[model samples]
Target: MNKIKIIAKKNQKEIRIDKFIKDNIRQNISRNQIQKLTISGKILVNQHIVKKNYKIKPLDFVEIEISNIPTIRDHLEYNNIIAEKINLDIIHEDEDIIVVNKPAGMVVHPGFGNYQGTLIHGIKYHFQNSNMKNFHLYRSGLVHRLDKDTSGLLVLAKNEYSKQCLSQQFYYRTIQREYRALIWGNILKEKGIITGFIGRDPKNRKRMTIFRNDEYHKGKYSITYYKVLERFQYLTYISCNIKTGKTHQIRTHFKYLGHPLFNDSIYGGNQIFMRKKYSNKNIEFLKTFLKILPRQALHAISISFIHPKNKKCYFHSPIPEDFQMVLQKCRKIFLQ
Candidate 1:
């Protein structure tokens, strides 16, 4: 059992007591558990038991007694390595939506190999004591996702209504998704669009390809508009905009264009050089000086869409750190 004491600061005034406890507590407790504690009089605001709906005021002292705290683990580490909490940069947030800068090498959702400690898990830990409910399954308020290796702006729906609205916009191809990437080899064209039907490569089941003839797979229509932002000796910095969101659309299209991402392994680029130069001997060594950039060199730099409630245009997210590092390396190697 552990106890936490919270003193509301001036900026935290008018914040809900439950929210305060949720944000401050280090223990791995669920929102449902926090609400249950509040109902059972296990939590006190200013020395008086209050309902879950009570909003905290400035200088209010909140105390919470947590019992039977469970040990949190991150299964993604594979060798019992715990997934550490990463500081996510929030570009924008409101009652309806949240936009965050997702870092590279972080999986967005839990999957077969990643059973615990993902982006969703962190959001759940952050909102564990709020009035918000039914979000446990969704893990935070995520409406859309960015691939684990691909870092960029991602949006989360604050409520079910917003989720449905935002999802519809994506389905209707109304949302504007943009990406910035460092592709291998110099691109001759300054601007162009790539359009084709994309599906899984028959020979390589792990990757997507622009299939010319395949009746069974039923490839989806995909399009991407790209403009060369800058050029290096053998690499090009390009800005990409996608009208349709297919699985690995930007990466696949770039692969078809004969200029795969700089360090992409699945689509084949210069991963061997990166791995060899960065050290790929053991896990510890890889995690150290090498930097675990296991995913492709692409990022969703920004996303713009209309607000469901007000129909106002909104944009969010920023260039991830890993991408920035890659850019810096390019500047040092080619520009110098």
Candidate 2:
């Protein structure tokens, strides 16, 4: 284990916690690493946990402890992950990159109890069949990720150079992504931008929530722009373009906006909001729609990014049948 301790003097007052730690500690941990430690309570001020942006005052004591436990990645060996043959919907493939239309219910990569039937396994199998060079099972070739239930276009690099270039594009926010989703309530705004700080829910680690006003210091800044595509009596279809890609960002932001994604199990969208009056027919239709679309009604519809070869690449994925079914049902039933 590695531990760092610092006591702030008058000269260090008001210095941001992350910067303060970086300057005081000999370790070269990054701002993001510091933020994660703070969030997880591994970093503390005056024996009390603080956010990454907390300002250190005079006599404030900061402690950081890094555990030596091996991560899940370290435990994974090449032989541990058997490359079971699985179909990959390869949308675009070239020497440097592969763009795939990932389907709902498919895990992007394996970890913990899930080590098989993942996209990585499928890709490994594909690489084996093609005798691709410079392929490593551990690398997985993934640059970014979509949730297991979120179907969309995902780009995979074929080698280290391509991976580095693509990863930088994502890190710098030079890549463009667009999504389509159906939410539980009709939005009055034709177009709007939602801004808030997003972080893990203190009570539930599995979910994310937005913070505003006094709680703004709790999470990283996130921005989501949405335009209403269609509105029904009980739900609305919208397109979302996110400026920041925080975990569960789209789901959390819309939930904060009072319109959780339809059928989203974790963010209060799985149940009907009975506050609004619903006709018996509409109620029945909603139940049926929920069954039709069991997952969150979100889809990554498009993405655009600069290729490693200095060219622009854009790809669009049509809405899946499940999404189309619910939308069709909305038109036929909710519009009646």
Candidate 3:
């Protein structure tokens, strides 16, 4: 089952539960289906099953769990993912593999709706033009993937043998990944670990849901170790070290901890959730500061592993200019 969780904001006006669901989903879901869900005890308002006609108030948390909802977007790294002249930041290269600093806004691989101008395209073009013979390219050399908007250090295998070796290292939790993320709130703890089960949200196939209870669908066990790097009055910068590479693990875990990454729209991080009292000037300043970073303020800064060929190598990508600018703005805010 998939789950859709929504929290009514203070800025929102009173609305019926059914209408709220449709408005938030932004997809074609009929009222009859919603009614059926209500009957089946699939809709919850503030942790209680609520009727379709129930009027939702501000600050009420609503959750809708369902079984069938098609994802809105589709992409597959199949025949359509062709080579192109895409810009690539090559950090390190060898006969067996290539390490790249993947920038934000570049898709890792192609899919049904998004097949053009991906990192794989660039890799393929690089291989085709190079004199590296005896190299057999399959699976586009990607052992793992980073989200389109997630800038990070990604290692790609050039041959099948390297791919298999690297894949096992990741599976055995030998690869080390450290990410820097700016999240919404100030966490009480300086350093801690978060553990939970994660699976596809039944209400929305586009997102992942965290399961606190083990019975919630035999979900994959996910763990994240976070250290508070810096603390703003309203926001906290953290370094997340993940043990298991579940999809959206860091982002989802931070949200589950009530500190969604800054500007992460998928997990409701875009909303201006602040703790301190706000003045007109403060709000205006915040609006301007937020505009500095268009995407989620998360960066995969460092990755280390036992290389399939070289034996010992570490890759690092500095924070992008946009993310740096956002940090500058936040620092200015703190100083003021």
Number of the top candidate by TM-score? 2
The C-alpha stretches of model 3 lying farther than 4 A from their native spots are 1-80, 132-136, 216-218
lDDT per residue for candidate 1 within 127-244, as digits (tens), equals: 4434553343344445566777788788888775676677556655678888988887778899999988787888988889997644422365678999999886566899999877
Write one digit per residue (lDDT tens) for candidate 3, span 252-333: 8988888888888888888787635777676676677678887888899999988876577788899999988878877888
**Quick one: ranking by TM-score, best first?**
2, 3, 1
Report residue 1 deviation for candidate 3 (angstroms): 16
- Counting clashing residue pairs in each candidate, in order, gives 0, 0, 11
- What tens digits encode model 2's per-residue C-alpha lDDT throughout 172-202? 5678999999998878899999988787899
Q: Report every candidate's CA lDDT.
A: 0.68, 0.81, 0.77
Candidate 2: list runs displaced more than 4 Å. 1-79, 137-139
lDDT of 3: 0.77
Instruction: For model 2, state the Cα shift of residue 108 in Å.
Output: 1.2
Order of candidate numbers by lDDT, starting with the best: 2, 3, 1
Better of 1 and 2 by TM-score: 2
